[model samples]
Target: MILENEIGLSSFRNERQKASISILYTYGFLANCYEQFYKMHGMTNQQYNALRILRDQYPKPVSTSFLREKMLDKMSDASRLVSRLSAKGLVVVTQNPTDKRLVNILISETGHQLISDIDSDLYKLDDLMNGITEEEAVQLTSLLYKVRNSLKSTYDNTVTEEQVHA
Candidate 1:
């Protein structure tokens, strides 16, 4: 169902309503797209994301903190996510040799194969952005970045409060 129909909100009243509707729809769409995108890989979105992060750091161990910084989902539990991948034999987590205080994560052979298999499928997922042209995608990214920068304080506060309550 359409968001307007589902929410019974024909039009927003003022800036507050516009912002709320934008946030709601943007989050909903991204979440739905993520669920569908990860389904094809036989993994949850978080698991897939962790695998990708490990791949990115291949030949170089990544710390939990580093993964946390790179993840799109700020709420993700890096330690738990790495543990889950380790359990699936998709990743390896070990105490850092140089720094015992830090844990290092690396992608496994199976993880590499899994990612390779999904590369082709990723094209289909990428196609979802076809709603906008290449230039538009760039502009949209710029706009999103600007918005995030402009509202950093408010966004951070909201997220921090949510996490505290959660």
Candidate 2:
């Protein structure tokens, strides 16, 4: 598919610019696709991601701050998400006894069941990427990692400068 036509854009300044836009567009499009699938299961993508993280932690209680660090949607309000999940009876939230200021969250039995119920569907959706050969998928993943790694030095420099100013 043509990125220009898909995004209703006629041109880009260069291939790099086009590629950058294409990657963003593809990410949003795929996220929308996942959103639609999860909608039928009565959850949003961010909610699902939070549940997945909590499930990974299992019986262990996690703080919103920790969830925030691990979330794919960094903009998500982790506290709000946890509240919503609690309301749905998918998670248990409690104040840490040792520290009133600290709150903890854990996935409940209902949450585990919900995850089990949705696992097959999620696995099938993930297989959509199977259109590409295994080797191609590996190469694509590596290239994406490389692209991000290439920007690390620039980010480090900016971070250090900001720290100095602060």
lDDT of each: 0.84, 0.89
Give me the runs in candidate 1 sitting further than 4 Å from their true place: 1-6, 153-166
Residue-by-residue lDDT tens digits, candidate 1, 21-127:
87777778877997988886788788887778888889898999999989888799988888888888898789999899999899999999998888768877778
Cα error, residue 39 of model 2, in Å, equals 0.5
Worst lDDT window (10 residues) for model 2? 119-128
- Candidate 2 lDDT by residue in tens digits, 1-166: 3888888888899998897788888788788889898898999989889999999998899999999999998899998999999999999999988989989999999999998788868876777687799899899899888878867787999999999999
Q: Candidate 2, 34: how far from true, in Å?
A: 0.5
Q: Cα lDDT of model 1 overall?
A: 0.84
Q: What are the runs in model 2 whose C-alpha is more than 4 Å off?
A: none
C-alpha lDDT of candidate 2 relative to the true structure: 0.89
Among these predicted structures, which one has the highest TM-score?
2
RMSD of each: 4.2, 1.9
For model 2, what is the error of residue 52's alpha carbon versus the real structure, in angstroms, after optimal superposition? 1.1
